[model samples]
Target: MSHRPKTAALIAYAEALLSPEGQRRVEAHLAGCEACRAELAAIEAYDALVEDVRSVEIPTIDFASMELPLAREAEAVSRQMIAQRQRRSARPWIAAGLVAAAAAAALWWSTRETEPQAPPRAEAPVEREAPAPVIAPEPARLTPVVTLAAGEVRRETADGEIPLELGAVLDEGARVGTGAASELHVRLADGTGFRLAASSALALARAREDEIRLELAQGSVGHAVAPLSNGAAFVVLAAGYSVEVTGTRFVVSALDGTVGVDLSEGAVRIRPPRGEPIELEAPARWRSSGGAEGGAPRPVSVRGLEAPRVAPTPVRLADARMIRWSVDGIEIETSGDVQLGLAPGEHPVRAWDARGRLHTALLPVGGAPVELSAGALQADAPRVRAGHLDEADLRPVLSRGMRQVQRCYELALRQGTGAVTGRARLRIEIGLTGGVQRAQVLGIPESSLTECITSYASRWTFPPPGGPLTVEQPLTLAPTQ
Candidate 1:
């Protein structure tokens, strides 16, 4: 069966049979094939369907009009013939002749009424397409009805959720609610599987080919969103709120009317419980909640934002002049030799010396104090990859440190070896996840040794911090031994 026979084809056959050529083919085939005979009979059952679609503007059909009366009529005629025969033998012959003529007339009248009629005018178009028309089929109708429990809407595309039998096909970047169910086998668009916790629900509103669907289904299941080679977006639904983010991060208490988003370092959008959606810079935080229908989000400040800092390069011995700091336009400044103690925050620092010379620098604020003095003021603590930085521009901070040991260790080992050393400038790139992007040894000596020192940072990772971009911890490095 290379091709299945279409009902349309059968309909066409019955139509063609009305033609001389169709009549010949049917007569030839029906003479021998019982299957063909059966099919013909079946097709005849709904003969009205083959006619013009327009004329079928059906009024209720009187089914009683179609009843068979052949048996009853035959029995009545037989009784009449028996009475005629008993009345007279001589007249019996005449009666028999009359009966034969009458029977012939009756048969002719019945067959005449059943003869096919000329098709109606309105049906010409349907007759034309009766040959064939293409129409794509819909999904096989699954039982035609779906029912879900309270807080239990299920959907293939995480957002358009509806309470279902927990068989929704969740795609990558989808979400479900908390407390929706404890067991669910959701297939993400990225082909990943997840089991929702009971009393939790979420949505995978975002889809990614290279990442885990950012599903926020109830009760934070923990996020392991697939990493985008370059970068991508993710979103999940919780309560009346929805979260959009790029790269991997974490969220806690996203059910019960409150949702927390700690973008452990990535771009994200937090739609609040009652207003507009806000774009979140990397290394930022957000919270959300539910309201009325798909409630709008209200912007709320991210908690634990490190205060902004001001640190300008001083000529080492030169008296530091005017120093000022501002993030959202809140400014802080100090003059000559005295440095302003700015709060910890990621901010651009500007300064001027007594010579009226002005300078600017980007300051990544952790919980530590940054001196406003000139050249690189080494931190008192062992900073992430902060071994021997020579470059004035490059900075890389480690948050999740255990992931890159070899890279961090080599920089430490090469510190004093002077084994072809310089300021040992190095770059440690980190995602919001604090994972290393590219580690390079810059402004330093070049060698397999130099490469070795630069390469030593191949093992650093950052733990969840206050922001998205990795806390760039500028460091110095050189080849050892």
Candidate 2:
């Protein structure tokens, strides 16, 4: 206690690998020691550098082309020696005397090889054309431009680090990093682009025509890749694995020794360093347990609602511990304030408090931006102005009805649309004494699933609201993982 913590202990503490008691001890010391805290920061920085080095792309080499010029030079020298031998062979006696003299000359030359020799006489030197210069293959036409830079984003180049601005073209090997709460978006000349999340580091490792590789050392990225030409590939290297895709919309993350991939559309092949490659299709999720070979992807039961094809309205929300919203049945989750694209309708909004309790609100989206406050959601209050249902009372009732929701989705999946996956919104009106007053389905196309859900929901009961209370519920349908 009187001395300082060792380097190994500090490392374990930084990685959160120490026991709870050890963590408490280290933290207590850190609270009083600035030098130890600085050491811990340096340790984390070095670890990040090592992760970046691991994601570097190894360039391919063509050995045949490199050796061609040397091979030709050796061949030319051999031909010149043959011609000299032929000239000497025409005079046999002279050639025999010269060969005997050459032996003694060779013996003398061996002993003097280490000594500095005099320059060749002007006429004694043989002239030869310099070997043709080796021409390198042309580099790929990869031009990436910064499309968006939000908050504190910087790019590292040979000329040193610079603040990344809109329209700046990124050079290959350049690394981009985002500070906390910052994000960055970059688009390639080929219509491929990616959005980097906060507190992330990514390197544009390679940009050859045959292959384009992005190295992700930390955080997450959402990518939209255009279809590549024949024999071309797009790859994302993260942690110890690589994701290769021709064209796709997906999300990849390399954070805290964990790597994950969520494929919304298109197909991809993931390769681990020591295992066989994994193939993934659309609407699937893959995660690894701190190693490329540790885990596999599974199909997700839920997916976010797709933004409307046409111009959709944007809804903004206030900061919260966690905010979840659903429009037309698709739900999305994020922390802090964010803008969401929603179709013209009334969407359900949910936010969590510090103690993890849910608060609910109804946000109407039309044209102008609508601002929602998590602290203002009153739908969950136990006695809300004498007409509302409290979140504490609503959550348990919905939880008990999840079986009906699953049943409806499973029945619909069996009805020849097995591959179909989407979200559906259900609207229910509860009357006094917890009676179901009305039930309706919104957002999803009308089908047997909708009919089944509506029929089951109308008969459900909940704790009594003083008066009429209407709420929207979200349901997601997908194949079993």
Residue pairs clashing in model 2 are 380-391
For all predicted structures, in order, the TM-scores are 0.22, 0.39
lDDT of each: 0.42, 0.68
Query: What is the lDDT for 92 in model 1?
Result: 23
Off by over 4 Å in 1: 1-198, 203-218, 228-232, 273-285, 289-481
Error of 1 at 375 (Å): 66
Measured by TM-score, how close is model 1 to the native structure? 0.22
lDDT string for model 2 (262-372, tens) is 888789999987888999898777787733433333222121122123334555566555544443453334454544445567887666555555677788876666777
On residues 13-68, what C-alpha lDDT tens digit does candidate 1 reach at each position? Answer: 77773577766765785677666667767787667556656576779887534432
